[model samples]
Target: MPPQPSLSFTLPSIHDNTKLDCRIYQPYHSNPSNPSIPPYSSSSDPSWPRHAAVVAHPYAPLGGSYDDPVVHLVASTLLDLGFVVATFNFRGASSSSGRTSWTSKPERADYMSVTGFLVYYMHYLTAPQNHARSIEEDNNSPPILLFAGYSYGAMVTLQLPPIDSFLSHFASPATHTAFADIRLRAQHLAEEQSTMSADPASPRKSLGMRFGGDEDLSPRSRGKHRAHSPDPEEKIRRGVKDILSRSKFIHRRHHSPSADRGTERNIEVPCLENVDNLIRFRPAYLLVSPPLGFVTNLATMSFSNLWPKKRKDGRTKNLEDYTKREESEVETEAKLTANPTLVIYGDHDSFLSIRKMRDWATKLSNVEGSRFRYVEVLTAGHFWIEHGVSQELREAVYSFSAGLVKS
Candidate 1:
């Protein structure tokens, strides 16, 4: 294959009627420009694609999305290597809901939803279903599903906790209520900020002044600055005013808490949603995905150290910062050692670490005495450059996935 094949579509993510724009690449068919993409029989019964590999993007707050060249490259790489690839944005990222937060519950749900969607589309056709057909292949199909992502995306994947225990977390009144509240807050926050900024009397400058510090910024940027100098209320008023003037801009650009874009909201809140999530994961692939730096901080910070510790009187110990976390540092045993998992951590991954990535592959995920795969691409940073990863690096991805398919 020249590269592999890939395709995009809008699929239902949040609800049935509302669709999330998604791109599903054909399994391992990289060369879209090729004379022949994989031939699909037009019969009402077409073939079922591979029942594996849901690909997610890195941190959306930091410009990561299903469409990023880096994440898609991996999707295409896996597609070429013979796996069904599904890529999408976190709810607030490209097009999915709520806000992009460290505890990416909706995002993870987005990933899980792909598995159900692919399986339904491909298999439902055989009996009383849609036009999708099962691809002619051997019968010993395994229900094995593979989930993976890069950087922020990887952290999202590792968040996949056990189904049973995880469900209870959602069922708890407090956690469920908190999640609903968070979702509502995100929506209103997006709206309130927008409405406040649209006033005709709003200042002439862009709110870039609030996030602004670098005087070296271009004139165009400075022109957009909401306040060149500020009073605190004026700054807030200007930013809220700016938000109103541009809803779409704010929805896509604004990050949470700080309300600034490009910030990664990976810190787990002590809220029911996050504490439950941290408590439930396999803990094996915790720091597996590469570009080591990107993962390590998230992993190390993942400790109870990030959360506020409590004392015997049921009062929580005070942290220097008002921000508090709920989870106490707890011992976690590895869960994924039994499932063969392949992880790819790019050396350039800034959010997470590569050493942790290799360690994950060789130890935790693979350590369960399961089949393991590792790739350290040379001359390649986090995202494989458009120029292309070095041939050696390219081979590692393809070769490893190919072996994965065979094994």
Candidate 2:
């Protein structure tokens, strides 16, 4: 069977309205002709597993983009395991519009926007009317969401708000806003894809094939290719405007006097309510070559409290206060320990010492009821360039994802 094509789109950053390039790959089920491929379909089978993943690349200033080799490796591995995978360019990376921030707050918001889109997309795609009934009557399992990252990206992922907090922004977004538009767009595209998946002969005019050269091409080469081909960015901008206009129309109709009089009620309420119910998910995390020590501090620009400071009363405050994390941070840590998480790093990493990484892993693993696990590859560097390191990395990712699906 031919490889499934990816759907490329642009989403606005909640921080500054910058356009971020994004792609989503659908999972492929095996064909009868090919027995080697596994049989799994999130679209057709109501009982089939429903899983989605969002992978963030390394730092932008260090030449990171959605096309990074490691990012692609992780995405492909997840895709093979029946995951609907998503990858995106952070601000100032590749075709995305903006400059990298000194502090990583804006970048964090960028990740949040993409994550929100995927959540709603999967919700609408999997929650058919029959599926909804089965969920309530048969007590079917909820979907799974995995938030994975590499290097500097992992550092940012670790600092993200809790799952419920991250999803609350979409529960009741205002009309005509970016959040509202994202919800609408996700529903529209998901419905379209679901229809196509149901009918195998349907023509996929919008989806483009993903070639090996496209995935491995350098950023410079990609720019040159974009210069020659028809522009997708402009087409995406027009689509965004259409969705925004549609949202405005829906808002007006929903607020009209007839709507309140029980004559012209909103049509989307039923679907949105079902999506709300389907929002319950088992969260998972995957961190590959996560940065540590000074590299982490540099990536997050968090040097302010690195040293002790004198108190206003002329007494030096205890340094322990600095180590005390905020409530959100504490909540994030709790979620990680409570759920399945996989951390993979190399012993010969250049950016961080092995001792520091080992200590960090040991501390997290020692926590009571911690499901966190780590794998240290021998002679592997930060980039996983050692001879057999990439294979080992892929195996670890596959094992972690398979376990989640089976459980």
TM-score, structure 2 vs. true: 0.78
Q: How would you encode candidate 2's per-residue C-alpha lDDT over 1-407 as one tens digit per residue?
A: 12343566778888877878888876656432343343333455765566889999998888998888889889888877888888888999887889888668888898889988898878777666545645564565565799999987887788787778868877766654677667766776666566665665655522432311243348898888777765554544454556555543322224333635556545332112224455566789999988877777666555565566798887554344434445545776677788899999988989777898898788888899999899998888988888999999999999999998877
TM-score of 1: 0.53
TM-score of each: 0.53, 0.78
lDDT of 1: 0.44
- CA lDDT scores, all candidates in order: 0.44, 0.73
In terms of TM-score, the best-performing candidate is 2
> Highest lDDT among the candidates is held by which one?
2
lDDT of 2: 0.73
Total backbone clashes of candidate 2, pairs 3 or more residues apart or in separate chains: 0
Enumerate clash totals for all models, in the order shown.
Answer: 47, 0
Q: How far does residue 345 in candidate 1 sit from its true spot (Å)? A: 2.9
